[model samples]
Target: MKYLAVLILLVTACKSPTNKKMEPKTYLDIHNEAIVIDTHNDILMKTEDQGVIFDQDLTGQTHSDLERWKTGGLDVQIFSVYCDGNTKNSYAIANRQMDSLDAVVARNPDKIVKVANSKALLKAVEAHKIAAMFGVEGGHMIEGDLNKLEALYNRGARYLSLTHNAAPDWATSAADETTNPDLEEKGLTDFGIQVIKKMNALGMMIDVSHSGEQTFWDVIKLTNKPIIASHSSVYNLASSQRNLKDDQIKAIAKNGGVIMVNFHPNFIDNSFKAKAQAFFERHATEGDSLVKSGMDTWYMQDYLYKKYADEANQIRPPLATLINHIDYIVKLVGIDYVGLGSDFDGINITPQQLDDVTDYPLITKALVERGYSEADIIKILGTNFLRVLDANEIK
Candidate 1:
């Protein structure tokens, strides 16, 4: 009985602490050390609409406000000057967004610096300031004018997404152009090729996130510099047109381009698409009414998004699904060709776990848990993007 008691005590003492999980330390520590950069964010729209200054601590959104970005250890952010595709005067709207960003930077010059080249970006980083860069969100914002595109670059726009939702007469969109028989595949006209050439010359990264298949290939053929798909996901995973196909991924890799993954739920999760479609179907008539009333696409999307937020919550996937997109791209094109492009204020809904820029550490943690090496994590976090920026900068 004495021996049995001694054996029991030994067993109890040696028992594993199943309830007390070990904290993941190495990856988290490595994440904090890296200079994290997000290639795309749209929080400027909030600053424009609600008179919410990005310099202040904003409460409701899961994006970059001055304090939040600092706490998140975000080194650089490329704010998207996004205007709806359907706008007849998109250039004006783009100008307004750029003005708004300029105002924000002017108001908080100590916290952020507008960077137009790799040198400025590095200087801002060394100064411990958040390097602010611009990426015009749609090609339409240039008004089909190459001069306007050059002017945007001069104004510090680093990249330009080709088109938004609807296909221009010159290029097809990934969204509706493929299915609609009436839609023509204009690919890139001579003017579009010229646009690419000018962008290459101006050192603006040619973006192909929303462009159709033909346009993507056309840009790939025309540009000598490394291109970027600023906010896209893997079509092979979600089977959504908004995501890049395997062949497209290969092409981007061949051109030494990077595909930045978007955080929108529908783009990452197939299940969310059905729910979003149902919500849109229910509001179809109202949406059409708003369109007929000449309501701006931004307002229209905001209205519908507010209406469907509750339903969307039921179907939104976990944020890990977004990381899966990164994993998919890395598998296809190697780790050097992928990065983050969280479309923060541009999209109405994000994945469940990612609430704001502060939640970026979670992505780092997830990548580590997925068996990514520390060196690989650093590359995915921002190093790869910085290399691309250095490679493609005109100066």
Candidate 2:
């Protein structure tokens, strides 16, 4: 009888806290265990702007800092090497961007390390260093030189976004397509085909983020290895020219590529773009004065937006809106084809909750709430990108 009673007690004690709900996995636990990779971040450009080094704390002023990246559990970050089309010396500017990143890695060897390939990337992550890499934001930076492309790859530029908002002589941009619909070449030029082959041969990932639809398809048809939309969102959700259409998203998946959703509220919500447009019209005179004053139009507008932070916040979508883009890509293609490319520092108005680089854990928590398994979240967080990276690595 005593044995029976003890057995009953043991069974009851071990009876699986079924009545008590299993506590959800802490976000920190998930974020810490996962190898988090942000494919696109533009804080490097900000460093160049203010002559401020990333090794120091750049809180409030920028979305990312060295310590903040570490605190955010950023295993790998591909710093964007970008200069708009106006710079006469585009190639020189690109080299200078690379130089800045080199200097940062030189200064903080323990905190971050520049990675040239998947092998080195994994090694840096294993050693608890943020694996730093370069992603040239515009093909114009190469100045139509295959040699320049080769040089960039050698310089640890793992990806080359075919275009920024402005298409070069060799490619067309989404912005150009939308604003002026009568361009001669909507995609890559013949020489541009040569560039694609060169990138493929060098094993550099091709980014179709800011490319026109024709440009996207042309590259999609040519690239041998898997490609990526490094920092684009879904057009269906936001109705922005910058975001990909359903067919494009499927094409990326069919080509074994991944789409790292951008966090721009304008790209995530159409209503936000409308609100932004209205705000811009309201401040048109101030914007022109700021431009005339040699203040960067972006900074002036940012200042105005912050001055109206409450109104701006009202228009800004919630964190769930950003996740919805992720969900759209995951649902349309598959979990293997979607990831996060926050476009932090590059964007002015971020989703409400994602204030800075430190807010990445919220994404994991949101995913858990959305019923994604840990494995699925891992794939979305970084593994999918790593797979694409490994595939594109030079043998």
Candidate 3:
């Protein structure tokens, strides 16, 4: 009887809750342990416009900072090298944006490193440093010169978005495709074909985020390597021209590329547009005053949006809506071709519960709740982008 009691006590102690050594990892653990990457962020453009330092504490004024990026568990980031078409020296201004990022890397050498290839990217991730690279958001910054494109690539730009809101001489943009009536052409020009070939030769991933439908098809017909729609969502879900149609999504998968979905509310939720439009109309006088005071247009909008965040929050889509975009792509193609490209600091608004860089874990948690397997969650988080990056590498 005494030996039986001793054996029972030992068994109970061994089965205690605190004694569980092989317990399953939670969503937070999975998120923190994965190699999370954000393929597009326009914080550099904001920093340049506002004359603010990226490594400094910019809690309220900006959506990203070095420390906040770390807190967000971002293993890699592709900073956007951007300028509007109005700039006379677009190439020089783009270089200045690259210089801004370079300065940030110099200031936070221990926290981040500028990586150009897959090996360096892996090394940065292994060392727990954010791997930084550039996705030149507008091809106009190349100023119709292949030499300038090569120079941007040499400066750590791994991808070149063929257009922004406006088309360059080489390619048409979504804005022109759906809105412009006087447009002479709607696809890539002869030089644009050359640009695609040059990017293929240089091993830079061709990004078609802001490209018009015709431009997208033109590149798809011409490119030798896989491409990336670096920051776009599904048009079926939200009717924005910036969003990809079902045919485009299918084609991207067929061409072996990934679509890193954007988190902007306007792109994720169709209804948010009318609500946002109303909000803008309600604050039109204040917006006019800010612009009249010589503030930048984007800055004035950002100011109004943040100042009236309560009104803004009422219209913001739930985080699940963004996930639904991911889910749609996953179901349309497969898990191998979808990932996150949260357009941080570039858009005026994000989905609810995703306020800034640190809110990334919420996405992981939501994925888990959505019944995605851990393997698929990891792929969606970063591995899919890595696969596309590797596929685009020069062999």
List RMSD in Å for every model shown: 11.1, 8.5, 8.7
TM-score of each: 0.85, 0.92, 0.94
lDDT scores of the candidates, listed in order: 0.78, 0.85, 0.89
Candidate 2 lDDT tens digits, 1-395: 24323432343233123335556656666677677889999987776666777788888777888999987778889899998876678888888888988888999899899887766776676677889899999999998889999998999999999999976888889998888857766888899899899988988999999999999899988999999999999999999888999999999999888999999998898889778888888888888888899988777877777777787777778999999999998888899999889899888888988888999999998998999888788789887888888788777
lDDT of 1 by residue, 35-64 (tens): 678988988666666567777777564356
Off by over 4 Å in 3: 1-20
Name the candidate, 2 or 3, with the larger TM-score value. 3
Q: What is the overall TM-score of model 3 with all chains considered together?
A: 0.94
Off by over 4 Å in 2: 1-24, 281-285
lDDT of 3 by residue, 12-117 (tens): 2332234257678788777876778899999988877888898999998888999999998888999988888667899998988988889989988899999988
Model 3: colliding residue pairs: none
